[model samples]
Target chain A: MPDVCKAPAAADALLEEERFQALSSGEAKIVEAAASRIFPTTDTPGAAEAGVVHYIDRTLKEIYPKQIASYREGCAALERNAKETFGRQFTELAPDQQDKILSAFEKGTASGLADASEFFALLRKHTMEGMFCEPMYGGNRGLVGWRLVGFPGQQFGYEDPYINRVVDLEPIAHEMPFSQQEALDGRKS
Target chain B: MAARADVVLVGIGAVGGILASELTAAGLKVVGLERGESPPYSDYALKDAVHAIVRHALHDSARHEPIARRDKEGENTRRRPVSSPTNQVGGALNRWTGQSNRFAPGDFKVFTQEIASGLAERAGASLEGYNVADWPIGYDDLEPYYTKYEYEMGITGADGENPFAGPRSKRFPMPPLRDTAKFVLFRDACRNLGYHPYRTPNGILSQRYKPPMPYAQGIPERPGCVYCGHCNNYGCHVHAKASTLYTHVPAALDSGNLDLRTRCKVFRINTSPDGKVTGVSYFDPAGTVQEQRASVVILGGYLYENVRLLLLSRSEASVHASGLGNTHGLVGQHIMAHEDVRVSGIFDDQIINGFIGPGSVGGRIDDFNSNNFDHTKLGFIRGATIGTSGSGTPIERYNIVPRGMPRWGADYKKYLTRYYTRSFDLNMQPETLPHKDNYVDLHPTECDAWGIPLPRVTFSLHENEQRMHRFLAGEGEKIMQATGAAKVWSAFSKRGSRWAGGTRMGTDPSNSVVNDKCQVHGIDNLFVMGASVFPTMAGYPPTATVAALTYRAADFIRSQNALFH
Candidate 1:
């Protein structure tokens, strides 16, 4: 298996074939804004910092048709709402202001922005899903979320534990977060 | 040109795949026809996970098509735009959770003893409205086949451990999977509450199998399961879960007697003037009508398609005007879907790695399932099995909160994050018996891409099933409460009737679609495979039993040799 934990360069070729670079500038900004809010850089790295926004944009272009359409609609609506309320685009809003806008939408307390609330909610849902779903999508940052939950990465058979006693399983990493692509490629060769 | 075959198998899946291998090995020529593409081993790699799991590449996207339902007035009703799209070739086996369980020995005979007896006493009630009957073959006749299925499918469980199960001659091929965090908590809690929790039987292989002899012939070297957190309703990337594609399909191909045609939508099974099957007409991928002749035919498609094929084949002036093999007008009559209910509980100190395991590897309490419990006084003839497992992903789990909790903000965040680690859930699989009124028929309003009327399922939960659902929920609540769960949220059975019945089985040709051998009555050369033939679904997953029945039916077809003439 190719190392998914490597820095984005070695897999960068594969990522290109996957069309991860196809996101327009506007689309990328919207996705970056959305991912950051859903998984802010609070306790850990936010989605944008972890490359999750890029991953989500790639997935929307590659995997799900339904998700792509919904995302496009949400992006348009969020911008319109931001322009109407704050005389600015959503991507240009201050961090605190962005948080307030998202919070109101999530809580359905947005004044004159009820429709935008649902749209933002949809954006939030998809961003978080893309950021933390299976690492096959280039998210989860080296399976960090899985590790945090103490999930043993792909071990065969738990009978050893179930039949014996409560076995505190060791966590496994399939690839490093970002520095192993060449090592994996060289090994395969 | 007519393609001749000693035996022609349709729907190269669990049952058909096994049958092809067996019949070809028995010195017979077999041609297996499949509607799905051949899935190579590499297609199940981690890279393919996105395509297979997220996109659901193999599933029927045709589920959104409009379909009509039959109501109580004997009229076709407009549907709310629904379609039953299963997997293509291996059918739903591709996306199943691999929970293999057998129906109780009594399940096969419920039509005669319970349904028949009830009709005799009830006013204006008769088996006339319903075609429910007993299976022609009994458990004793199928025990060997069940064992064979267990070995071939690499089933895992402690044999004879389930108190309610029938006596088996041998144990499971492999021991059960390790318990997930949720299962550990549930098992410990059940133990504290004085309930025995045994390992549930599943089709997932825990350890590598080295057959004493050559295991099912031509099978590829399969790796043991890697617990890749992608087993529920998703095909296993490692082929450790022994679906038909992994175990039997390749074996059949190795014999060189099987030929599969992808995207071949079967239109009808054509018959000669003498009432003997001549061949089947189907629309190939390029939209050409092609007829293939066969000495014997097997309709091993899943439940809905199997019945729909027969219904489409029926001609006017035929004795079975209702449908093919409906000489007794019982074809597509008794259709049963399982009743499912779920309950969630919150804990103050537990954060299970819910997303780290397959959907079926958990603590399943089957003591209350099927005829296992005393239901004579409860007014319900059947019961259900209660179980709990972890299938929530992180983003999804963040949204799962106790009812009435703040949807967002500091308070909501605090409560969700605190309980997210300690939250657990329990789900119930209850039996839905065949009712005369519940059936699958051609929708009067909707059509598929091929202009064939979609199968509209009209079904509802019976009063008995409702009561059983409540009973199972009550038991689960008690279990959850006893486990120190701070808060438990549960619901009674929803009133919407999606559970279908009718088209049941029995020895009598007058009431069932197929005989004990799963051969269609009157249509001696045709067989219908899948849950459609099930007399009544037991209160558990049906795929395992469906695979077992396929194996048994294939064996019956081989032994009879009624086709080679």
Candidate 2:
């Protein structure tokens, strides 16, 4: 398998553009738009740049199949709000307009939604999970999440002297950070 | 087909694992039924943060057996997606942070102390309805067992440090795990504020195994803790953390007399027509119902399951006409959960390096725990232990920013980068008094996949507990501020957080489920172990105390060999 951490920009783009099995096309568009606004890119690459939507889509399909319906309902509610407020679908809204709708959803003020706050909380939780989770989960691409907050991913052990010291050690750069499959395979072998 | 054994132990985790080892060593043919399968110790090797911590790979998914919760009686209970304690071979021990602390001497006689000082009444905390009871067994009775469990489980600690600790016959078997930078800061801060700071005892081995091991069956040759940051909520990949799976269960298996049947879920304790426990009925992994007959039965499943099993076993035709040991309808009453209050501090001056040590390898001040402090003026009966812990993984740390910081945005990202390593939390585990209203029973509507009624918890914090939590939170803030933190903030749980109880032990059958020896009242052959038997929760982790009680119960059962025969 190719090293996700060391993959080139073109390969990363291709990985991000891969088809999602769980989310509908419209749902995928809303998720990407909402996630970007939730963790907007500034000086650092945010959720969208980290492929959070892809992570949520894959996780919904594979890991948490129970959440698929909630995601669909939540996205449909977001579309309804968009149509009622601006006479357009959520995907066609500008970045600021998307932010306004998402903020309402977060604050539970979005109309015509069943448990809009619950959906907002779920989306926010998934977005954060995608941001901080290991790169192999299709998010945190290129170790950008770890680097954003200076987390050293899965270091075996910090030596004795390092334990009681205040020195900030350099984070390890993994050529191919082991995915869940690789870790399981290694354990089996 | 029915299999027979000298003893049948349900739930091969902390309490059951210890009993399994002890009873089998005494030549008793023991069968341990565990609902969860015993995965190879190497299966604990997946160190993925998302899988281990977020998804809880080692725990039973709530979809299968969701626990229902409601704050008070007459309220509708909702199914919770996850239970506090996981069900597995080693049980919660596999994922526990290894904070091995003994209940202080005062913890055993909480009711006696409250009456003596009249603090319960004077505080005006509505003490009328609370049913806190003193333990029939005192600290002196369990001291030797505590010492044995400490040494047997390879607890790491230094002696003569925790002056507030109850008298121990001997010192810990292993020296305390190496401290992290945060520990050093916390220690200095505590000492500066006129508190006695000491190393917290933990189950993780500090160094590799030395000769003269405590157990009759010696510990397996394994590496000691390497200070891997992924300790709490995550199983140790290296088998360095001394979970029951790595210690007692393996030792029991080595005894050659223990038949540990994993993936066998005990549904009920089968009783004879003459009011004696005949055996237990369990569902095998393939969904086949199997019966195991034994002279003695021990229930050591997590607190909720232990009570739920008894309630589920109730039938009008049963000899007792009530649940076993539920003649007084007190089988699942007086439950208590430790009021956990966390106070975190952000330091701009120094980096605490919060992620570089084992979970419990931090400093602690026990001077405030139990009756160590004066509660007369404080309007509380008991107190809490203030401690610093080190298993703050990056994902958890991402959410801990100074009070006004936004959860997500450029400023939040900046805050995470700056304070992730420089921040630390001083935790307060306060003792919560049991109220008559706080109890566990079966939910009327919700049922698990096995068709067993989900355990319904009815609990709410007493005013006494709330006052105690507020005081402890203030103390935590003081400690954090004394450390020269740039900003400090506190967080507390709501009124009802069900952590333990349901099958409490005491002297009277009128008020308690089990007796002093953890044997079910009026049932000579049946015993219940673990935190379910705790009359009142101490201001500390209950694992070490549970292990000690299991040791005592095992000895008691051995002494009654004639009953088994």
Candidate 3:
């Protein structure tokens, strides 16, 4: 079990996976920017720290191959919308500017994108899943999401019945004792 | 392999597992057919909320087997995913919330006690298209079987806690689970509001215990529940939950009289011209269509699947021309679904750890359940069982913030970070009345992976359900307010849960599919067990009652000499 309550090294950075499974480098940058805007870093870790982009990438490869075309089309159209509106690529925009475009896509107000609302919904859901799900699934890097909301991941039952109180303890991931690198490296092929 | 057995059961899940064990234990040759693979326990490992909640790893994914759904009878339907039916060995029981409860005494006689008791008139409930009817049997008839199933499956609850529950022949195998501080808060609040709150009966063992009496043979001692915050939608890593997968399935196999076949999808209930069920034809593991010869065939799949198989097996050459046991065109009607209505109260401080226990190991009040309370002018004949609930894992609790909070970004994250454990929810499973139009039929367009038409569920909430939802949600809010919460918001799901019926059992054959003996009316050797034969669904988890009914049916199937002829 590891206590993730300690301050992390940093929260914001474009993900540097060994290689993107489904997304290109540019598409990964845009998706990561959108996810960061969806769960931006205020004072705590956000989707960036949680490696939500990698989650999206992995999910698109394994579970949801059908969604890859939607992601590509949505990302490309989103870039066009960014250039037409903000005069810059989506990843180069300010946080508020990125928020504006993502917000339009969420509410179905964005143009040049088919299933903009649908794409945004999946991105949002996958981002949250990345934030909160186990590290074995390629997200929740270092258990930041669990620590952010005081969630203990898979610690077995307590010895006593003191259930109604703050439980701050060292959190443990499933692939603990073995590094998360095993799962990541294993899925690389 | 084309095989022969004394008895054949479809869908080796909660009910089928019971029949498989009980019949084989009686020295009967039983063959059980299952539609999914028997994956090991490691597949149900804890810590991976993504696999359980998101991927629905233990259950069916809607992407492949979408059941077409519509809100009205004639409306154009959309293909919606049916996620409850598990595609694994244990089926839905492997990932249920494990709330074990018996349908109340009045529940079996809904038509007599409520519809004909003038309660409907008093409440001004319009029963135009509603198909509420009395069950062929009563609580007294099934009390012994309920006791039998409880011991066989190992339930945990105090004998005399739920006053509304019917008389019990014996105490539960394990005592009631320990109360949590969250339960205490809900209990005290219910007491303040003049509600009779009790520890919810659960199938999970309170402590390490084995089954007792004539039913305990071959079953091993199970560990007590650890309250590891992963019960619903996740298999028990500790084997604390009393699943038939571990208990009865193993016991059945050990009897050597049982032959269980997995990955065999039964598409049609095969019958001879004389109208006795010869056996069932199914797609075996290697995609080979095969059949088994049986003196008796039992339909023990989920409610909707039972309906689909019956509809799929219909033949003009058989006694049940319209469908199997649908003698009077009543194979898949009178369906009832339970709507989960909830209210969340936000406290200023962390009142409890919101994610560290079994979903059902908490306080609940049955004061408003069934016809326990008056329905006068309430516009609803039945009520809901309201209780305290827990947020499962982190992903499970991600969307449960207060109303009007943005689903993402700063404010949402802030509220969740501090108040994730501060909020307590009181959920109510409202008793949805059976309507004539809320039925299951074969889909006209959508087909499953097997090239068979999917079962189309036509369902919508009626006034009785709507009124019940509002009243129960208000009552839950009142209890939350009684707890001195800073804010409270309530919601009710449009889609329902705990689906029951589609092969309703009654003494009268005109409107029912099965008789009191669970035999299909015209075809004596064809029996239908499980919630599919439920006359009406009470506002409680249906597993306990479904198991009890299976126990009762198993006894009848073994004892009925006419069926063997």
For model 2 the local lDDT of residue B370 reads 84
Candidate 1 deviant stretches above 4 angstroms: A1-41, A46-56, A63-73, A79-121, A134-189, B47-52, B57-89, B111-137, B210-223, B317-322, B327-329, B346-351, B376-379, B391-399, B406-423, B491-503
Model 3, B1-565: lDDT tens digits are 4667889989888988888888998888999898876756666645467767777632433455677888998899888776677765777888888888888898888899888779899988777778888888899999998888888778888878788989887877778888876788888888888888889888888888887667658887798988887888888988888777898899899999888999898999888887768888999978889988888898888888898998888888867677887767888888888879989887875467767778788988998899898788887788879988965787887777677888877877788887777777888888888888888999887798788998899988888888888888888888889877889889877777888889989888887889887888888788888888888888887898888888888888888777666
TM-score of 3: 0.95
lDDT by residue for model 1 (B1-565), tens: 5568777677776767777777777777776666655544433333223344444432333333344554454655765432223435555566667777776687667656565666323422222343345666667777777788787778888866677777787778788877677787788888887676766787778888633343575666676776665665556777777767767777777887777777677878877765677668887878788888887888776656677778888767555456778676666676776657777888766656565557677877776775565555565665667777646445546666666875543455355445645676787777776777777777665777778888776766566666667777788988888777889877654433223333444577766767767787777787777667777676777766666777777777778765777
Q: Top model by DockQ, which number?
A: 3
Error of 1 at B316 (Å): 3.6
- lDDT tens per residue, model 1, A1-189: 223222233222333444444466676676667567665544433454346666676556544445666666666666766777788988898876777767766776665554666766666655555544556556655554443334444454344433212226664434332223222211111
CAPRI level of candidate 3 = medium
What is the full ranking by DockQ, best candidate first? 3, 2, 1
The lDDT per prediction is: 0.64, 0.79, 0.81
What would the per-residue lDDT of candidate 2 be over residues B1-565, giving only the tens digit for each residue? 6567999999988888888889988999999999876756444555566767666632453456777988888988977766355677788788788888888888899888876567666754556687778899889999999988877777889898999888889878889888787788899899999999989998888888632544655446557888767777777877778777877787789889999898888898988777888899999989899999999999998888889888887767766666888999987888888757889888878777777777678989988888787666577677888999635567666666667777665567677767777788887778877788988888888888888889998888877787888888888899999988999999885633326677889888888889989999988999999898888888898888899999999999999967777
DockQ-based CAPRI category assigned to the predicted complex of candidate 1: incorrect
Q: What is the lDDT of residue B271 in candidate 3?
A: 82
Q: Kindly report which residue pairs in candidate 3 clash with one another.
A: none
Weakest ten-residue segment in model 3 chain B by summed lDDT? B56-65
Q: In candidate 2 chain B, what residue range of length 10 has the lowest lDDT sum?
A: B210-219
Greater-lDDT candidate between 2 and 3: 3
